[model samples]
Target: MPAVLAHAFAPHSHDSATKTDAALESSRHGLRALVISFAALMATAALQAVIVARSGSVALLGDTLHNLADALTALPLGVAFWLGRRAATRRFTYGYGRAEDLAGIVIVALIAASAALAGYQAVKRLIDPAEVRLLGLVAAAGVVGFAGNELVARYRIRVGRRIGSAALVADGLHARTDGLTSLAVVLSAAGAALGLPLADPIIGLLITIAICLVLKDAARQICHRLMDAVDPALVETAERILAGVPGVENVGAVRLRWIGHALRAEVEIAVRHDATLLQAHAVAVAAEHRLIHELPHLRAATVHADPDGPPGADHHAILSAHR
Candidate 1:
């Protein structure tokens, strides 16, 4: 690292301590909301499952399973959020923010597993039909669960955005799945009452398939996060801004990555090496300053200097002839 660039890291790395404190404070409120949401989901899950068992409604049972899974998933999300806010130690210099991503991976896996199991049972039931009873009760319970989940989802979403917590977003997604499955359960219950008992198991299987597809998508997102995949848009924007810097020749390579909550970029540029050391340093500092001002996400930038020989000198050929 150039001497000028060496000090470049100081500005943002210092603020990391402040961000850690802010994260800790924000997570406390988020955790409280999460706990309440978990309790509500668990109660709804048990009530829906009992109603399904009594009514012999396969659709309702599957919907209840979704709620139960959502409830279980919240605990880990809460834990991950709390852990993410903790201060970085020697073992974890980046803190634990990645915990949310890990929790999301686990949640998607669990939901997919449950969906596969439900689908298998639904397929077996389709092979040999069974009489369903009290279809109205099953439908009513499903509606109740849907309403409850929607309420919880709304609050969770608010907290998530307020605190910038990805785990909170995952929890909201879980609640949304419950509400959607409940609607399907309501439809399947109605169909069963109208002498289309096969629709109950069929709808159950479809809901399961839908959840599995969602989990597959979630898995892809988690993989991208873990890989630290650079967002193309951000990289393109940085390239544009870096290229526009005064006194800069062809901008060579640009790399953007996360240093903490804030995004950081390492930029390379070719400049006249013959320029006074102070002049090159000033130009580099200007470039770095402009990038951060233009894009708040950019945490740091570095410029590499190259000697600017006299024009038309064929500097490369002169070295070649000497060899």
Candidate 2:
């Protein structure tokens, strides 16, 4: 049996007080981005809702509702980010970073609800068709909606990627779909003006279906995060970093997971069997240092040093199966 020495380090080598302050600052930045995007989408939805009321265009109404739903996603995400700033309690030693994943689930549900509501409204209008009025104003409103959603989408996606917030990125993609739905409204307005009155409801149905597709995608991403699935490329990056460290004979299991917008990893490395405990520990520390420097979005890491040998059943055991 190989002697395995394992150590876990909190975000960086900073003191507890410094780590707390840093986490708080990160949450603040995420909150700021969420707030700004929320405001922009709300304004856009409000403007579109006014036109929906006056023109009674089912397509525009569907688009407006989706925009509003997308905007509301900011609330859960903002709360999650705020919660992420809180210090770890005895009950939750890993802190509140997992809140972001839970919030993502809420966002997915909101998206599904918006799609269902829109689909119902569109189907109702199709059964009892309403005469759409103010064709020109409705078209202009569609243009405004498109412009606003596109702007918000760009901002949200840019900031979300910058901060590695998957929920924010999903929300941004949601806005992008809203922008396309707005375009569908524009086409419907043109069709209505051409004496095809049923076009509005038809386009509304299309928008509803489009939203459902986006919901599928968003749910997939959020579910993946909740399940702790990480990109293979990231694993490869970790392995390469570990291999480069001096005194490291080989890299073993490299596990990674997202904790909110940040990443935490568990790395297993092998050192020479003859190496002293102190030397092996030094190598683990060096590997951790390199990983923190090289890995993007890394928040914390746990390194386990194992002696290089044929194999150890204890080491090869599944994580849950092990004691």
Candidate 3:
């Protein structure tokens, strides 16, 4: 498995109990916001689509598609919220905490794809301009949609960030797209009203470009996490956890990865062969607790103890009799 990076993505919780208060509360509130936002966006997009179709406005049509894309983002997060609460299984021991992250990745990809489609259509329309009627109505609709989505996006982002849910963050990105699409429509309408026929298609392409840029960062983050790209600072954090323990001489093999929203680790520690099972278990338990305390995302830990001294050494972490 690839090493997940700490900075690029929200922490993983591959092993923690999602039943915990913070996770539960965050998921609840964030999911609620996403559901409402998605509903409102769907309605708004329908309205915008109707208006744009009637007027033959490329910018308004693109914005409408953007609003529809919000549904794709919100629906996945809602499912992840419910699924993430399930217990770990034999088939998938890590639990479903990562389902939300996967959902986020899918959502970002959807938005980016929508943007690409919009840009292509906009360019085609620019090549063969159509005479659109009633520029004022398109502008009016955009203003109303912008105001509505702005409120929803702002509130959703605040709640999502509080609980560290990437699903909600991706949903917030959807809402933000609506806000920006509205802003673009407003500019396009103004230019249309001022007798600039090219503004509508131009704004459509601009909105599409913005979506691509935003999604690129999100894609990079998802790819890095899946690749287990650990960073210098997080590795340093792991090193500190091992070095500080009382009986540990050094950590030999440190296999650390984000376990969902938590860090899961397997470490080999150097210790004296004279150490009893009880002593070693205690040390390992202490180290596990400290690792969890230091990194809130750590879900599970296994510490293997290796003898400090000679080649003809007695077992330290596990006895041969037990083996």
Candidate 3 lDDT score relative to the true structure: 0.71
In candidate 1, position 3 carries an lDDT of 72
Number of the top-ranking candidate, with TM-score as the measure = 2
Query: Poorest 10 consecutive residues of model 3 by lDDT?
Result: 1-10
For residues 107-220, what per-residue lDDT tens digits would candidate 1 score against the true structure?
A: 887787778777877887899888778888888888988987898898888877666554576568768867988899889988887899799899889888767766776677
* Highest lDDT model number: 2
What candidate 1 gets wrong by more than 4 Å, as runs, is: 1-17, 238-252, 258-323
What are the runs in model 2 whose C-alpha is more than 4 Å off?
A: 1-22, 310-323
User: What range of 10 consecutive residues in model 2 has the weakest lDDT sum?
Assistant: 6-15
Predictions in order: lDDT: 0.73, 0.85, 0.71
Q: Model 3, range 1-323, lDDT digits (tens) per residue?
A: 12222111112222345435555565577678877887787888878888987888888887777778876678877787777766679987877777766776777778887888889889998999776678889888788778767877887787766665544654576577678778888898888888888988999898888777767766876676677655557667877887899987667777776534445677777755567655655666566667766754455666666556666666444666675
Please give the RMSD to the true structure for each candidate, in Å: 5.1, 3.5, 7.5
Give the distance in Å from residue 162's predicted Cα in candidate 3 to where it truly belongs: 3.3
Q: Rank the candidates by TM-score, best first.
A: 2, 3, 1
